[model samples]
Target: MSGLNIISNTSLTMFILIGIPGLEDANFWIAFLLCFVYLMAILGNCTIVFIIKMESSLHEPMYFFLAMLAALDILLVNSVIPKMLGIFWFDAREISFNACLVQMFCIHSISAMESTILVAMAFDRYVAICNPLRHKSILTSSIVAKIGLVAVIRGAAIMAPLPCLIKRLPYCRATVLSHSYCLHQDVMNFSCADISVNIIYGLIIIISAMGLDSLLIFLSYFLILRAVLRLSWEVRLKAFSTCISHICVVLIFYIPFIGLAMVHRFGKRSSPIIAIVMANVYLLVPPVLNPMVYGIKTKQIRQSIMKAFHRNATRPELFH
Candidate 1:
C-alpha cells in the first residue's frame, strides 16, 4: 500500500493507550498501586508547597526553588497518572488527537521546567555556600521570581512547536500508544510523513534546553565543592549535607529520564515493557520521592510539617 493511500484510509482522530504491556491481566493490581503512589505524590508535594508558603522563615531563594520543584512535581504526575487510572480501571483507553498533543506538551514542557528549576536550585546552593555574604544580595526575591518566569517561558517556547509539528504529520500506522499516556516520540513514530525534521528539532530541544541545564547544574556543584573544600572540616560537612536532598532529587529525576530517552531514541528493538517501565519510573517516582527527601533531610520543612499535623489534630471538629 502506498503511503498516501494508507494515510487517507487510517483514522487518526483518537489514539489508544495500553497502560502497561504484558500486565493486562494484572491491571487491577496495577491500578491500585498507581493510585496509591499518585495520592502520596499529590499529598507530599502539596504539603511541601503549603509549608514553604506559610513559613516566613523559608523565604530564602533555596526554599523558593524547592517550592517550585514541589509544585512542578504535582503538575508532572497529574498529567499522566489520572488518565492512567482511567485507562486501567475504567478501560477508557482512547485519547483525542488534540488531547494527546496537550498531554505531550504538559509532560515534556513540565519536564523541561523541572530541569530548569533544579538548575536554579543548584545555583541557589552555590551562591549560599560559595558566596555566603553575597547570597542575599545576589538572589533576591526579585531575581528568584525572574528565574521562575524564565523557566516557564523557556519551557513553553521549546515545546510549543512540537504539537504543531506532530499534528502536521500523517499517521498511517497503528494509533495505539506505547504507554498509558501520549509521548511525542511514540506519537510521531507512527506518522507516515518524513519526521526527520521533527526528530532533529526534538533532539535540539533536549540538547539545548535540558542538556545545557545539566551542564550548568554540574558546574554549579563543582564550584560548590571547591568552595566547601576550603572551609573548616565541620563547615565542609555542613555544606555537603545541605546539598544532599537536592542531589538525591536530581538523580531521581535524571536517571530514569535518561533511561527513557535512551529507550526512545536508541532502543527501538527493546521490549515494550522496558520503555513503559522507564517512562513510569521517569514520570512517577520523582514526584513520590522529592518531597519525602526534602521533608526528611531539610529540618525546617520537617518541623513545619509536624506543626501543621499537630495543629490540625489539636483543632476541634465542627461535627462535634
Candidate 2:
C-alpha cells in the first residue's frame, strides 16, 4: 500500500490507478495470470506474422491483411499490458498526466487501426469467397499497401486529438483512474473542465470509426451469404470454411469491445470490477485467441506453423 502515492488538489501531476479494485488481495495471482496471457498473446501474434511472412504461398492479399491484423494485435497488447503489470506487481500505478494521455492515445488509436484492418480482411474474404475470379486482380499489392497506409493514417488522424483535448482540461478533483490502463472515456471522467465536447467528439469518433466499420463488415458478410447460397452445397461449405477463422476473430474482437463500450456508456452504476474485467476481456481475449483460431481453422497457417517448428528443430547447430 506504500506505493499508493495519491495526490490531491489542482496541482496534481500524477494519476493513481486502482488495479482490479476489490481484487487487491489477489493482485499477485492476477498479475501472474495476466503476465501469462500477455506472453501467449505476444507469442501467438508474432507467430502469425512470422508464418505469413515466411510462407511464400501466403503472400496473397488475404494473408497480408492477416499479418497486418496480427501486427496490430501485438502493438495493441504491448501498449497497455506492461503498464498493467507494473500496477499490479510493483505498485507503479502512478502515471504522470501526460503519460496517461499518451497511453490513452496508443490504446484507442491502435484499436482504431485494428478495426480498420479487420474491415479490410472482411472485404478480402468477401472477394475471395463471393467473387473468386476478380479477387487477385482487385486486391493487388499496391492496393493492399494503400489500404494498410490508410488504416494507419485514419487511426492516427482520428485519435491524435484526444491527448490535446485532455491536455487542455484542468483536473480540479481526484485524479484516480478506475482501470489498470488509461482509456479515453476513463480519463475524461476525471476532468474538472467541461467535457461535453470530449464526450460528443469521442462518441462521434466511435460511431464513425468502429461503428461504421462494423456495419460495413456486416454488409460484406450479408452479400457473401447471398452469394454463397447461390453456389452448390459443397462449394458453399468450402467457401464458408475459408471465412470461419475471420468470423471467429471478428466476433471475439467486437463482442467484448461493444460490451465495454456499453458498460462505459450505460452501466456507470454497475460494479467497477465488472467494468475492469470487461475491459480486460476487450483488450486481452482477441490477441490470445485470434492466432489460435486461425491456426486451427486455416490449414495453410497450421501447416506453416508446424513446418516452421520442424525446420527449426532440424537445425543441428542449435544443439551445440
Candidate 3:
C-alpha cells in the first residue's frame, strides 16, 4: 500500500498555471474579475450573433462572417478564461497533462480559425467594393458556407499536431505553467524532451498561416485603396466610410499579433508576461470592439439593435 501510494504521489498529475500577478495571487477577487471579463465577452459576442441571425437585412456575406467571428470569439474565450479563472479561485491549480494539451489545442485552433475568417472577410469586402457588378455571383451563400467550412478544417489541421507533440514530451520538472492558461509555447518550454521539432513546427504554422493571412489582408486593402482612388470624390468618401471600420479592426487584430510574435522570438524569456497580456488582447479585444465597430459603421445592425431595445421596453407585463 505504501509503495502504491509513493507511485501515485510521484506520478505527474497537475500543472500549476501561474496566473497574472497581483489580483490573481490575492484570492477569489481575481477569479471574480476574470469571471466578469468572461461574462462580458460571452454576452457581447452572443449579442452580435443574435443580432446578425435575427435581422434579415444582415443576411449578407459580410455579416455572415461577422456572426461566425462572434461565435468563434465566444468559443475561444470560454475555453481559456473559465479554466484560468478556476486556477485563481481554487487552490488546485493543477490541470492534468491531457487537459493542458486540450486547452492549448482549442485556443490555438479557434485563434487560427478567426484569423482565416478575417482574411475571408477582407476578400469579401474587396470583391464587393472593387467589382461591385460581380459581387452577387462571387460571394454566393454557398460559396460563403464553403469558405467557412474550409476555415474550420484548416484551423483544425493546423493545431491538431500540437497536442500530440505535447503528449510525447517527458516533463522532468514539476509541470508549472508560467501563464494563466495552457499556452502551447509555455507547455513546450516545460518539456524534458528535446523540443526543436515542436518549436520549428509551431513557428512554421504560425508564420505560414497568420503571416500569410495578414499579408493577404494588407494586399486586399491596397487593391481597395487603388480602386477607391479611381472613383469620384463622393464615391471614394462613401467607400472609405464603409471600409475604415474594417481596416481599424484588422489593424487592431494584426498589429499586436505581429508585435507579440516578434517579442517572443527576439526578447528575453521573461517576455512571456508580455505575450500573456497580448494573448488576452488578441482574444478579448476583438470581441469587445467588434460590435462597437460594426454598430457604428453598419446602418442595418444599428437599426436592429435600436428596434430590439424598443421592443423590449414596450413589451406587455408578464403578469397581465
Candidate 4:
C-alpha cells in the first residue's frame, strides 16, 4: 500500500528491458546470432508467402492457412526482435510506457493469432485427409476467409485489454522488465498496484486462446490418426507425410513456450539468464524453423520454390 502510494506519486514514463543479464560483454556476439536468426526468419517466411502467391498449384486451403501462419510469424517476431537487436547492439533499451503497451499488445495478439492459425491448419489437414471428397466444398475460399477473420478477432479481443489493465497499475520499482520485450506478465511484475485482476485476465487470455487452441490441434491430430489407421499402409504413410511439417512446426513453437512457462512457474531461484534465453528461443525458433520444415518436408512447396528459381534463371537465357 505504501509502495502503491509512492508509485502513484512518481508516475512511470518508461521501462528498461534487462536483456541477457551477466552477458553484458557478450552482447555483440549475441546480437550477431540474433541478427542472423532474424534474417533467416524474415527471409524464410517471406519466401513461403511469395511462392504461395506465385504458384497457382499452391492455391489450396492448406497453403492458404500456411500463408497466414507465415504472415503471423513475420509480424510476431518483427514486433520484438528488431528492438531487441537495438538493445543488444546499440544499448537502446529504454522503451516508453505507451510504446511498451503497444508492443505488448502486438506480441500477445500475434501470438494468439498464430496459435489460432495453427488450429485452423490442423482442421484443414483433418478435412483434407479424412474427408478428401468434401475438402474443397467445406473449406471454400469464403470459409478460409472467415476462419482468418475469426482468428484475428479472437486474438485482438482477448489481448486488447491487457495493456490497459497493466497501464492502470502503479509501478514502484525501477520499471525494469526481465526480457527484451514487453510481455504481459513481465510488465505486470513491475507494478506496485494490486495485480490480481491483471493475473486473472492474463490467465483467461491464455486459457481461452492458446490453451484451447493447443487442445483442439491435438484432438484434430487424434482424429486424423484414427482416420489414417483405417487406410492401407501405403496410403497411411502418404497421408502422414503431409502432416510431418505441421507437426515439426508445432513442436518448434510449443516446446519453447512450455519451457518458458515451466521456468516462470518453478524456476524462481534459477538464473535470470535462463528465462531470458528461453524467451528468446520461444520467439525466435518457430519462424526460423517453419519455412525450413515446410520446404523440406512438403514436396509441393519445394517444387514451387525450385520452379520459381528455374523460371527466374531461364528469363535471362531467353533474353540472351
Best model per TM-score: 4
Task: Report, for all candidates in order, the number of backbone clashes.
Answer: 0, 0, 0, 0
> Candidate 2, residues 1-320: lDDT per residue as tens digits?
23344333335677888888777889888999999999999999999999998899999998998999899989988988998899889989899877887889988998999999999999999998877899989999999999999999999999999988877776644677888889989988886657999999999998999999999999999999999999899998998999999899999999999999999999988988889889999999999999999989999999999998999888987788
True lDDT of residue 194, candidate 2: 77
lDDT of 1 at 285: 93
| Sort order, lDDT high to low | 1, 2, 4, 3
- Which residue ranges in model 4 land beyond 4 Å of their true spot? 1-5
Return the lDDT, model 3, position 286. 75
Stronger candidate by TM-score (1 vs 2) = 1
- Give me the runs in candidate 2 sitting further than 4 Å from their true place: 1-12, 317-320
Query: Model 1 segments beyond 4 Å from truth?
Result: 1-5, 8-11, 317-320
**lDDT of all predictions, in order shown?**
0.90, 0.89, 0.81, 0.88
Task: Sort the predicted structures by TM-score, highest score first.
Answer: 4, 1, 2, 3
Candidate 1 lDDT (Cα, whole model)? 0.90
Question: How would you encode candidate 4's per-residue C-alpha lDDT over 1-320 as one tens digit per residue?
Answer: 64343464237778898668888999989999999999999999999999999899999989999999999999987898899999999999999889899999998898888888899999989999999999999999999999999999989998899988987888775777899998887888777767899888877876777788899999999999999999999999999999988988888888898788788768989988899889988888899999999999999999999999989988988766
lDDT of residue 136 for candidate 4:
96
What's the lDDT of the predicted structure labeled candidate 4?
0.88
Candidate 1 lDDT, tens digit per residue, 159-234?
A: 9999989888887647788888988888888887789999999899879988898899999999998888888999
CA error at residue 179 for candidate 2, angstroms: 0.2
Instruction: Please identify which of the two predictions, 3 or 4, would achieve the higher TM-score against the true structure.
Output: 4
Using all chains and alpha carbons, the TM-scores for the candidates as numbered come to 0.95, 0.94, 0.91, 0.96
